[model samples]
Target: MHDLIAAPFRNEHLVLRPGSQRAVKIGAAKFTDLENAVKAGRALPGWLVDVARRAWGVDTFDRPAHAAVLVRRPGPYEFSRATWELNLGCDFDCEHCYLAEKRFEGLDWAGKARLLHVMRDAGVVWLQITGGEPLIDPQFPAAYQLAHELGMQVELLSNGSQLGKPRMLELLAALPPTKMSLSVYGASPETYDGLTRRRGAFKRFTRGLDAAVAAGLNIDLSLIITNRNAHEADAMRAWADRLGVARREYANISPTIHGGAETLPSQSPEHLTQRAPFTGCPAGHTFFHADPFGRASICKVGREPNIDLPTEGVAGLARLGSIADSLMLRTGGCTGCQLSDTCRVCRPMAKVFQEAKAPLKNYCQHG
Candidate 1:
């Protein structure tokens, strides 16, 4: 019921509002003061009440701390962000999808609710709910509502196929996500439908996109460029520009997460740009990913040695940092390559490419 959330982020304390971008950093004393006020059922402090009204337009002037704020207890685990795949089933079957098998399997509603709680306890604040198409999942509404109610800033990643539906639009309009990231496949229906291998798919996507924009929901576009739709790349960019929404293009296609070569042929070789060198990442140190079944991994690209959140709970995450360090070691095909300075792919991704038996040209500078 509360709109405000106060939580520990790494070593600092932060006050965040769901569906808003503003974050206020408070000192340790103010955090403890808020905790005491909530414990005693006292009204919020004057500064915090003013911050509430100014930041999110919520007036907590005379409101008790517990009534207006959900204070997240500090946890030993330091993760602050996570991505959850609601389901693997999608309305459109894109050829370049990373999931090799899009079998519709996931945790049931009860399990999903419990997993969200586990995430909260692990100190997650920014949550991305994705899927083969998350909007198509049956329990998406309930699960998304629960995430919001738990004081997590939710971001929805979808193909924009279901956004046209009245109920879907209504739910999002009522409890808006931080952003709706919709993937744009092609500029024309013929190209779009052909690429997704689903007839009438482009029409449905356009409808959903228009509806979302009209509803005043925050949206960003992921322009997916593949060999099938590479010719329409300019058109896609122009369309996104015309819409005046945030847009980014993805030209690199990777092997499926299962290390299958089925999706590699869709890569547009001409459009394949060199990625920046693999600098260090904060995958396990600051963030992690969760599959539909509550399995947690360092990130989407590195799935091995993951922990089952449903069974192991938050304590299971303690090993991820170590797992990440082991996964990043230069091993196998990458051992003694001498091109470590210019390596574009991380070790986990390189290992996936090796498993897929993809051509060295696809992922290595050695080619």
Candidate 2:
């Protein structure tokens, strides 16, 4: 069943169509073999065959594999449940902005619509609108509404500057988000503003948070742990506690990268050693990132164009499957490392190594 369900990735020419009822087809083949495989029953991967039979009511191999396919399809396509970076630009000039160098022009209405349509068609059931700050984009409300209309659970990540404004709060109230993530660099204005490099930002962010909470929006306080603010974790937890939010609401303590480059800081080794093992770095598997410039990356940190989906519509998501297949075949430091539990590897990392013609030691540590 594993082989059958994960079969398309093995053949470069195979393609799976996404929708309420999924279909699989091999390139240049007049008929799809999915039905044949389903008929083979016991000969097929047991888990896949069982899943197909139980889920889709397809008990025979000669029948369609729709019963075996999951919520969407049996391919590499997946969507973010709780995170996304909508654009690179932010309203605040945070000193630690990872994409500080990248411009932040918001996507136009048309582009936003296209993205929404593509996301809905690709089965992205949950999405988070992030950015330099998503609130800065005027089209944000429309994007949010569209995602909600398509039955996608939506979340917003913001520096919280705009939320304090009555109009912005009203807009947010009108849209009714599933959750809102506020990045609190510091508990106090002096410290927060110093980190953001934007005076008075801390006040605005807190005000926005207060307004959001009052409006009954589900809120998660995001913290960026770095050399300057790792000690603030307890303070942040206290703030969440005071606000009646759960402590587990805090997200991963993302290590600040030096200007989003592939190179790690001098303390990276120690940082990696101290960090807990993360089993879920589902880049090519469950999530992907597409920049404003139309380049599709497997993860937020992996910013490389493994595939270009422009004008390809839903069919373009197949590239993720292809990329995952490619990565599984990769040999070198990553091939058999037990440290894969702690190591992070993605197309962006691979691209950096491919371009530099050197191994990526800093990004992927072998056990």
lDDT scores of the candidates, listed in order: 0.91, 0.57
Give per-residue lDDT, candidate 2, residue 129.
75
TM per prediction: 0.96, 0.66
* Per-residue alpha-carbon lDDT of candidate 1 for residues 125-194, written as tens digits (9 for 90 to 100): 9999998898899899999999988889999999999998999999999998898999999999999999
Could you say which candidate leads in TM-score? Answer: 1
- Displacement of residue 118 (Cα, Å) in model 2 is 1.5
Measured over all alpha carbons after superposition, the RMSD of each candidate to the real structure, in angstroms, is 1.5, 11.1
Candidate 1, TM-score vs. the true structure? 0.96
lDDT of 2 by residue, 148-263 (tens): 65545567778889988898888767666666778778777777887677888888888888998898877777765544555565787788889996434322222232223322
Model 1 is weakest, by summed lDDT over 10 consecutive residues, at 54-63
